[model samples]
Target: MSSDELTGASEKKGFSTRKAFIFAAIGSAVGLGNIWRFPYVAYEGGGGAFVIPYLVALLFAGIPLLFLDYAMGHRYRGSAPLAFRRVSRYGEWFGWWQVLITVVIGIYYPAIIAWAIRYTGFSIDKAWGDDPEKFLFGSFLQAAKTPGPTFDVVPGVLVPMIIVWTITLGVLAMGVQGGIGRTAVIFIPVLVIAFGALVVVALTLPGATTGLNALFTPEWGALGDPSVWVSAFGQIFFSLSVGFGIMITYASYVGRKTDLTGSGSVVAFSNSGFELFAGIGVFAVLGFLATNTGQPVGEVVADGIGLAFVAFPAILNEAPAGVLLGLLFFGSLVVAGLTSLISVVEVGISAIRDKTGVGRVAGTMILGLPMAVVSCVLLGTTGGVFVLDTMDNFINSFGILFVAALSMLALAWVWKRLPGLAEHVNAHSSIKLLGWWRWLVALVVPAVLLVMLVLELRKNLAEPYEGYPAELLGVFGWGIVIAIPFLAMLLSLLPWQRGVDLEDPGSDQLDHADRTDEGSLR
Candidate 1:
């Protein structure tokens, strides 16, 4: 074990206060998914009826698993790799897997942010012109005619991407308190305020009720569909940012006395609440678009990059205050996406610092520079969207969900530490988690995730996703999905740094020691 590990003193870099930690955690959870993915997924799953399964998933799988992550990180006081390593020598690889997934996400996610940044400017002049779809795909992106590995870089996209990288690296280099914590404080409130304003304005639009009716008119029959239930669980899992090692890494900064359960609940519900809020605004605007275009809301509703860039811009063009509204919409995306990008890169940053003992500035530059360069170079190309779409599907299914399932299994089954971890959480929190929480984390969450994985795999294998080319799916899609875990396991075989301890029991032991010391004092 390393001297620092032996002394338990090296892991001192943390958020300056509890509030900063909460905001940062919230920033991580409320990302592009909240804005882009949730509403569509909710709509497709069961519309208004989906809320029931979603809430059930949150209580049963999302929050319970979130508690597990916080417990692991707080108890171990380390990034995912160190935290998992402390559990078992082999556990470190899972941590690396999570970190690797973050790296992959980090590569392409910022490119979308770049698009948002450009669109924010375009919103000022309605530069997207009459045909927003043609402008977005042809004029701005110069998107490939087909889904292939073509590399025609667009300067418009590349330049903004450079700016995005510069901002991301700068914030990350400032260390946790000055960089992430400070940024979160500013960005999270701004995001909520801006989005809140947008929602209010959207509700005032002519077809707001029509949009909302489409969103909340629950198809009760959807509740009976197993796919709707699966979709709910998937949305909760991805939306909360649990399985990706973000919560674990973020919680590693907490003090021993920090209230894990209360803070976790706040983070969990805050993310969900924001999703619901965003949905209201999103569907409201879509309703307006449908009314303006004389189309049904279903015909106009879109998701992911399409919803943000293409459909929304087209909708804004028809608005009375198109420029101002467009600016606000895309600006919100830029802010939300940037905050998320910060959290995603931090996973890699934290891992580097732990593994190499590098300071924050160097670690940020090390990973940030390469990630920025590659994102700009690759995603700036004509085929960038194709690659981004393919990679996203594969990673979310195999990379993130896979790691989450492994994490729960490792904690609940391999280490047999689920009950002990629950005790750790209850010991420090105002809200006490019951034994059922253990069963939920141990059995329920993993099983649901496993089934989702199988179904997704079956669907993908059955046919090309989105009708993309087979070669693109083979290389960028299945290729990345297969490579990540293999790389993680290989990396795990390497020796730990000299004096680095893998078995340091974290906050639980320290709490016990404190109580014992207090008894003696009494």
Candidate 2:
């Protein structure tokens, strides 16, 4: 809560306008998960009826957490670690935990994007041929025999991966407004148009109605299942990218006068709308696949890598004007994935610049080169798929949720900074954050996160994740998830540069709110 942040002043770069910030935020939110993860999670939860809990989760947990991030970043006017560091001495650990989580995500996120890049080209010839599954694992990936580290490079993956890193780092080096903001302005609309066209084409296919029915046909009884509710909440949390440092870092780039609450609402709704749109397109295609193959929709549907690389490619081969369908779908993935990856990688670059007071290029060089090397070395190898799959699962389940809950507790009950944060947001927000908003952010969201964590722990402990070997799970999945926090703590011990102001702002009214019976910011 520096006076500069209070006055809407910035020492670092920022978005030129509110529209850019909104576009940038939406770009981060609408990602690969929207395309592959949400539809399956929705169908599994309760088909169309899953929208009930999903919307509830969005309103109650997702957006609340989103605003919480916004307040912290916009109020403190720094990267995640610097922002939390401004809150109090003990709070920086949570910030670093988020930063480290982004690091892990950045390491592997681009490989998926690269896959989409190559596949977009592969669509032209139906290069995967009849056996898409085998081609994915055995041919394109050259997947290793076992899930462990391997230096053996796969040219198909490596080349595209290098290109992905180049494109991402290039954009990041151009500064916030010129690179991130402008790219979102340019690309988000393109993504919408391309994916929208794909949906239209998908609807025109035979059995599209059957697919729509299978997708939208709600199981009324699923609402009674606690697991379905958990699925809905999980989908909302992950889909919004709320808990992680992404929103926090992104929000810091926004102008202080911006209507953060309004922007947040816009980003949240746009993300969910895209997800639902994606579900429609995916199911329509799946229905066509079922009709063509003489199988049920259930058998044709999949999630994660299987949905994009295997099922879609198989579906593409049999459809009329198959090349256009493949291009639209896979090309959409590339667009969606690039925007998300840039956001992910930007978290690290911004953190570096804030700590060292480096130029954008210097920060990009420091973070980008090493990140790209590791991304190419580890993720571009034959064993990359195993690492990507395991890391993506554990990190999303544990890394993000774990830190999010802790952050809420630390801000609400520990430091007692929620009032000040709320005040900061309310000052500029078009939609006021009231007492209920505080309660939702401080208590309800944390409780939901804890429940999700417990359920995830129970399920993972019951069986090896995806039935991968124990050692692989231990090293890649559990090991990485567990290691991030401890590593974050170690990083927090390092000193900030002279340029970083660690001082707290004047009187945050730490106890005045409770004493005066002020439960919310006006």
lDDT per residue for candidate 2 within 34-67, as digits (tens), equals 9999999988888988889998999998898889
Candidate with the greatest lDDT versus the true structure = 2
- Worst 10-residue lDDT window, candidate 2: 513-522
Query: lDDT tens string, model 1, 1-522?
Result: 444342233223467678989999999999888998899988887789999999999999999989988988887767788788888887898999999999999999988999999998998888889888889889998989988756677899889889888998999888777788899999999999999989888888888899999999999999999999998999899888898788888887656778989999999999999999999999999999988878998999899988998889888888776776777788888998999899999998887767766677888888899888888777989989888989889999878888899789888888898877788788879888788988898899999999999999999889889999889998888998889889988877776555455675655354321110000100
Tell me the lDDT of candidate 2.
Answer: 0.85
TM-score of 1: 0.94
How many residue pairs clash in each candidate at the backbone level? 4, 0
> Relative to the unseen true structure, what is the C-alpha lDDT of residue 198 in candidate 2, on a scale of 0 to 100?
96
* TM-score of decoy 2: 0.94
